[model samples]
Target: MTASPEPTDAIAIPDSPLAVLQQVFGYQSFRDGQQEIIEEVVAGRDALVIKPTGGGKSICYQIPALLRPGLTVVVSPLISLMKDQVDTLVANGVAAVYINSALSREEMLRHFAGLRRGEIKLVYVSPERLLQHEFMERLGELELGLFAIDEAHCISQWGHDFRPEYAALGRLKQWFPRIPVMALTATADEATRQDMLSRLSLTDPLIHIASFDRPNIRYTLVEKFKGIDQLLRYVAEQPGQCGIVYCSSRKRVEEVAERLLSRGHRAASYHAGLPLELRQSVQERFIRDDLDIVVATVAFGMGIDKPNVRYVVHYDIPKNIESYYQETGRGGRDGLPAEALLLYDPGDVGRVRRLLENSDNEQQLQVELYKLNVMAAFAESLTCRRQVLLNYFGEYQREPCGNCDICLDPPKRYDGTEDAQKALSCVYRVGQHFGVMYVVEVLRGAATQRIREHGHDKLSTYGIGKDKSQEHWVSVIRQLIHSGLLTQNITRNMVLQLTEAARPVLRGEVRLELAEPRLVRVKQKDKGEAVLSRAEDRALFKELRQLRKQLAEEADVPPYVVFSDATLTELARYRPKTESELLGINGVGMRKLERFGAAFLALLRRQE
Candidate 1:
């Protein structure tokens, strides 16, 4: 609940003052790249911190903000985020204020006046506000310490959430030459990272990249022919669990949320088109646990601080792996077991393909699209899902997770050496101008009119794979594309070509492991039978919920505004008998305890 000790001597140099690292920010130690990145920023160097979400990125800037002599200006993207951050800072006894567009003219003037008088340590502003002439003029007058760009990936066109305003951040360095700048993003691929540096005009910034692995999250991809029914079943099984279901379309979000609500789940929909106040209210309710599930599009989550989200379900496949990684990273922030589920179909791939084709940079977009197609292939892959996911980020795992579907019910591997050779041969024979469907047809010896006209049936390889269905061969090609044995060229022509790794397989020198495609069928389980026996736990949970409701009523706030279901679950499980014990709950800060501790304690004592 308290701020960790700061590292004072982490950046101490001979020319700099000799001080212990723990004396400054009240933190006793440094995380993986905190000390190094902090030193770089303090020594007036530009840097990019690519730490994972909840990976102590704040310390990189908070420490530098305290160490430097002037005010640190942070350009955030959301109003609610700025408020939450500023509130936390004030609670921690630090001076922080924000100037968002939500404020009235008078309110804005007062906050600007506070900034000018040097009464604030940090000032959070949206990019649109910072672009204002009056705000820019005021910013020029202030002695700025560090210009921090949160969610820096937005600056890159290749990133998921691209903002035009972020591209304009280069002007900051031009205006304030001596001030140090640090850019931070929770997720960025190699392409995105390079684009951030180039777009921001950072001068050889020191790059600190933490590991992308979220070991606490259990990744699962379920094929859903009846997606809505399956989704309802899953949600019912995890009753009262806080989770997010991402839909590609706003309509899908509405439909999914409505379906969940009809099925007796506390669910809500959030999209860009929603009313501003309604969106804010929905977000607040979800954070407070008045809502158990939030069905949203890409618009909903950026800088969300809810820590105990137990699951994240992707209703549609994302456009790229970076977006998928960042979205799913929202789960398991508290280092507890969490799940990432994706219910996808092959048609989703075509939709994503069209989206990529419409993008401005076709080549970069194509590469990213291929990456997504690889993810789709991964969803259907018989190998450990974790292995394929980690492989995309340029990391590898030798052994299976032993927890994923493939590991639990081991897939039977067949000798695909001949099949691999035939698939690769078809690519060479077809002149590499055809798509996967065409390639599969050619290999399966299907004597269609087009194939006969092209004289493809005359080839020796024709009819060789007739023993397999077209779908089977298509799955083979997909797995090959994902395994790095084949590459899909999106432009010039959408065709499959063999990569270098496929050479050995084609020559029969190496055998490839291939799993037979199984028809995924979701068995209907009785909802009552599926529910775990948490009778005592549920009784305590209800008591805690009632206590929370009382506190919210007294405070005139929503019940969730008091505490999250996860927090209440913790209280029930731990049975925090004392105030000190209650303080250890994730969302129970000093202010919350001071406001509602007695009511909760009274209920706990009565239950005991």
Candidate 2:
């Protein structure tokens, strides 16, 4: 029901998504699995694309929106996500707009008018807004295109961030019988995936699950001791880079932010407890590159679209592996080398588990507890962290990544049969009623009052682990829990209890080969990568960034919309002087070349 066969823009819709990809989005070819997904959607087929955060998931639906006959309706979870997508789309010359609570009524009316007139190619609305009776009636009056559901994982109750409104999205297919619908999510397991498909009523959709590996990110996990010192050291290694340091509580967020600010890091604090306007301002400043880092709780980074974030540091462990993956995915979005470092204490698991325990719903509690166990396993895994994560999502890799801490410097393995026996004996001597920390203290032979009250000093297992550091003892306890020889009794204040699997180890019939406490090694700080390789190119890249900032400020948009850092790097390398040459760059599309090409060419000429 498109109004006419006339193409919307200069780039003719000649039944080729490749042409649209080049002239509009400025890409020569699709990345792995993108071309096939785009072809499915463009051919009026429903699709389910599970691409990683930075793997160009947007293109799979965006190109189809361009090639489709009518306006594509994108149902998004957050208003910020909608705004970010529409901003980039409009910057690239697509007729895209969003209607959300942030928009004025008059602005919303104008968008509605444009949408009804078929002048807008893509319209983004929240699930709540899309379900409004008035909005649905308005939509019914116009010719509809494909339905693109971003963050489709929220439809399932088991997803990391479930939303009730998402559950109502199944009405889309029932209402628009003929139009195709595509669902996209950055993180979801097989259960969530199946739930997403069934909930959306997707009829035999083309399911594309790209590899969940974010190879650009170097994963590092450090045992948290002298946390502030460790943080300071890591920050010192990464001077003048954008990052997010995630804390578990609002108090810690403020403290970390204040300390970073005092140390001249240009940091801001963000949490749900902050004032609405203040939080928005901090997010806007961070996205605009005015702030170098944001020290925040998990509430932050939901819809962050900043592309140049060089690192993501977790000052505390996340609630689950999915949350961890999604949070770390925020960094290195430009596909440049980046870092994901998590400083954690094994005790952090108890704190997170307690949060899960407070829930009254038994089913929900079980699900959350299982997820927490998996997250803890990830933090404590002696195997490759990437392999563990991929395996969690049912993806397999034969070789270790060599990027994570485990793969880089393999942890030393000692026949911990004696050590394991010592730890288990200590837990049992403590009557299996006390928590892991208490058992650890009993093993460490700490002369605390609780130990005195328990009268456990006389036991043979007591002081057995005094030869090892307290951290080493904690690591041993964690490894035993992970190895199935010990289980945390969550129903009973998370006390330590041995499983039947411990009998062989306890009897010395089974040998336990546990890894020793690993020594920390910081990879030589990617110094050559701090800037462009050559000095002149570095200067040009900086100048180009300034130009981009200026153009973005003028247009009232994020700087990434003007040009990403990767594109600027290419521009600096190639020093393209002509429109054709600029178009040859990865992110230089026709509309951008036509708008800002002359200015860049003039600047390059002046530089020469």
Tell me, by TM-score, which candidate is best: 1
Q: lDDT of each prediction vs. the true structure? A: 0.76, 0.81
Q: In candidate 2, which residue ranges exceed 4 Å CA deviation?
A: 1-15, 273-280, 414-608
User: What is the Cα-based lDDT of residue 394 in candidate 2?
Assistant: 60
Query: What is the per-residue lDDT of model 2 for residues 340-412, given as tens digits with 9 covering 90 to 100?
Result: 9999787789988988799877766776777787688688777678877776676755467888877786666
Where does model 1 exceed 4 Å of error? Answer: 1-29, 351-375, 415-512, 517-608
Poorest 10 consecutive residues by lDDT, candidate 2: 1-10
Any idea what lDDT model 2 has?
A: 0.81
RMSD of 2: 19.1
**What's every prediction's RMSD, in angstroms?**
16.5, 19.1
Backbone clash pairs for candidate 2 read none
